[model samples]
Target: MNNIHLLDLIQGASGALDYVNSTVTGHHRRVGAGAAAIGGAMGLEGRDAADLVTAALLHDIGAFSLDLRLDGLDFEADHGDHARAGFRLLSVHPMLSRVAPLVLHHHTPWHRLPPLSDPGPGQADTPAAALLANIINLADRVDVLDQVGTRRVVRERIRQIISHNAGTVFAREAAEAFLDLSAGSEFWDKLSGDWTHVREAVDLPMADDLISHDQLLPFSRFFALIIDFRSRHTATHSLGVAETSARLAALAGMPPESQDRLRLAGNLHDIGKLAVPVTLLDKPGPLTQEEFEAVRLHAAASESILRSVPGLDDIADWASQHHERPDGSGYPHGLKRDALSLGSRIVGVCDVFTAITEDRPYRPGMTPDQSARVLRDMVGQGSLDADLVALLLDNHAEVAEARREAQARAHVEFERYRSLRVDGAAHAA
Candidate 1:
């Protein structure tokens, strides 16, 4: 946990965001690569360069908050809501605070942006925030254009659109930088090539040092907010599960460190849900076999994303194994009781409790007796660990109350986020 690299975490989180749609599968990585190249050509180096690329990777993050789909591929779509939402979400992050302003204006037109005074001798020639943001804007559109057609056609069209929009949609310098970079076959090769090679091509600085455990909480919660905020029906689900799982872990006599890890696992258990379509998630009737199969990929998706980051193996296992059953009936993997870890069982129990108790778009939450009965039946059928199920059922009042309080707080945050989207749309209009 202590040895997790900052860049790996950021990449993993961005990877989850990429799962939101098929059209934008690797959009963030390409944008990050493009921004790095453009920023370098503009003489951005060190922190300025790194922040710009980082912001590019996360620029569309507000899509989840706004419940947006693939509209980002439409160059003329209204992106103000997602841009503002990304700003609001990133502003509170401890390590990512500096990039918030960059993400905030990633969609702003060059002509509409406020002017900035040139920095003193030691600083970069341009104000880093403004220039960095414009770099992302240019890179983003370039990648979007790249998605429209074959390489030859897309390259020509990219030149035309970028040339036309310079000084309007994009800053003149950034646009020029991008045009120059994209003229080469090398640029397109890296853009369409592997991300590791892209980083080397652009000389992008990735933070490889270990991040402290204290920093993991905010990032975990950041992910939880993104995962749950995709729909009104699920706005507070991850928080409920996280808090409930933590309480249950405590009651189970787990050590303090294990409890903290379990909390992180709880917050991120459904991260793969980002890959699932909102229609499937909110559908009222039972899922068709095809739909159920699509939904079932979430657990493996969660494990894949989490495992991509170093030193998060324990957390990843705990989070991804939440669907496993003691009788080897669970999906993604059919681990039996002997194969399941206690941490995994704890998160699994909490997830079930939260799901049954939380209100859905189609129905009200189940009563305590109803939820308890459900849990007990699962215990009896070997679907869950009996002792853990009993612990949650016996202290139902306390654990359920903790979940309520946590989700209540999360709801307020969600409402505030909604207000930001409304205000942002108005501002954009």
Candidate 2:
């Protein structure tokens, strides 16, 4: 295969930053293209543009390592370390080094830097990499809001949201420019990435390994079921929440495909919990410090296991980032504010609501009213999205009914489900 093809494969499989990649499944390459177009529009030219494109493609590599070790975590793992790890791993690759630092600190934010070369110890400060790093960072956030396809929103919806977030981290000019471009007619269609190159690119074994959307759905559901299977305390937890969330998204006028993705993400949001020891997950009482740290690794773990499965990688961000907080205090990646995709953000709220409202091993479930109150408090604190939370609360009665119905459904249809595979070979041929 050619070098470009090889690099895209490696980057795609890297699962580093969790920005625009496969964590959302059907939207994987499309999100990457969005980031790239915005980067290009920013006048990031030549090798710099390629680097941003490369970084944009594989920003979530840190997830793979974190998820791999989660299934039986004996120690408290800090997933925030993934950005640096992804940077290091790609630094060794000839094609990816330019993008490595960009990917590394995508989670660390541009404003909170101590300089790329820390004056103190050998620990390098990565925040001062370059403007491209910052540019790609903003682009990632823009695509996540994705004002497209959801009941014919105003063209300026993305702009309005970005306009509201001008200070602190994102510059008013940059955000406004992104909004300016996104408000145009052709941007949304082009934002999803230029797939013509991918189609015409030279073929390879790995390219043949690409997983399609259909194969991933069942796998995603089953993977989420594994989260419940890990302990009686959490059995069917994700599926129940998934059904609830999907039903809610449908009610709120989200497109059918987007709603399907939300439900799938809700179902698998806790798959990272699989790597956690049953001892820690099933504890009858509150977790110790060390134990809580172990609990945080599951999201990272979920990201890892799903990375290898090709087409399903986008779901990783949604399924895995379910626990991320908007305030930068959440675990896995500490992805604050606009760093999260809308689907992931929605799943985050749904995960909390479903878990709190459902029966648990240690305590009685919170009433829907009580869970609504708690979710409201979280929104007030910036832990969840107020808008999505409001949507859920608005339809809580109907969602509660769906949750009731999902209780009897198995995560899969049993006899019809099979292991996920890709027709990469056929595609290549």
Candidate 3:
């Protein structure tokens, strides 16, 4: 296990979530900033503050997996199902299990909360968790409120809303802290202006336990779920790429560490695609120039999201460059042959291979021979790396087997997600 700042990873995940919908771009970050401010005002220090911010950033994670049309809905209107879904997702992870309940009750009103003294079955029902959840509830509501016109007018209106909900939607202490913090114009300015800076200002206590590459691999897989789970067409895309890339790296005789990094890069290469609309991604017909341009921006977005992590810089670079061509005809940053690293080249190859071999909305999966021809054609056009393509072709059976196995597992997960939606809908109806 390696010593890593867990907060940085959370921030990166938050960045990916921001891309899910451009309208809600900074929603998570703003909520996190507000929660941290409220936490500070309530005299929370060290780990308490850090945990609050972490929960806030991931508070809406369940929404990503949901089918809800969340474009303009207010916090109270959306209810608590997504909160329950998010709690279930986070609680499964060892590093994030502690904050699971905070997310679960983020939308729960203070009046409905169980008394802190008699928390229910789970530790998640404790006073600390409730306080953190209430703070997130207040912060999330604050971020979604209208902020049009003058700062003074906006602040006054927001303050009134917060005050009106006190002891009900908002815990009295959390509401009081936010009300006190809102009196200053700086608070409003930071919320509307540079929320990233505000979030960066607060330092989270470092984790004493370190995570190794083996342990960290599960985190990458989790992200793959977040990226591909949004639509059925792309459900197995990231996992296939991860498996294919690792297999290719092994065939190329790269060291074990390089192979692991390659697999991680493959899992994250499409992390930026979260920003592209699900409709756009699932469109069967050809895209408009504007839509294609939006699709192209994911590469750059992937880099921006992952670049901030401490030990993941190399992985970030490779993942971001997955779309770059050897001929400098690629998007985001059209780096030429020599400028691209070997790891980048391998990921680029695997990404294209996986896409061609996978079932897409408009097209069926290609046969191995068919995919080989397309890859060869790209190589001839000076786009793909010829040597890598040749190596992949030489080991076609092994590469295909790896991709099938990985994607088969992803298919099971996708079916499970679909089943949940069906059950939820049936229950609702």
In order, candidate lDDTs are: 0.81, 0.58, 0.79
Give per-residue CA lDDT, model 3, range 1-429, as digits (tens): 235566667777887887765676678878888888888888887666767988998888877744743533454474566666676567656667677777777777887765433223434546777788889988887877743122334668889999999988788999998889889877776677643643454444433334577767878888898789877678889999998999999999999888998989999999988887878887788899999998999899899888867678889899999989999999779998899998999999999999999887667989988999999999999989999999999999899899999999988876665454311121111
Clashing pairs counted in every model: 0, 27, 3
* lDDT string, candidate 1, 75-190, tens digits: 77767767777877876567776677677678777776554333223322335677788888888888877774444345878888999999898889998988898788888877
Q: Model 1 scores what on Cα lDDT?
A: 0.81
- Cα RMSD, model 3: 3.6
Scored against the true structure, residue 299 in model 3 reaches a CA lDDT of 94
RMSD of each: 3.5, 19.7, 3.6
- The C-alpha TM-scores of every prediction are 0.90, 0.48, 0.88
Candidate 1 segments exceeding 4 Å error: 65-67, 116-126, 149-152, 195-201, 421-429
Shift in Å, residue 87, candidate 1: 2.5
Worst 10 residues of 1 by lDDT: 116-125
Best by lDDT: 1
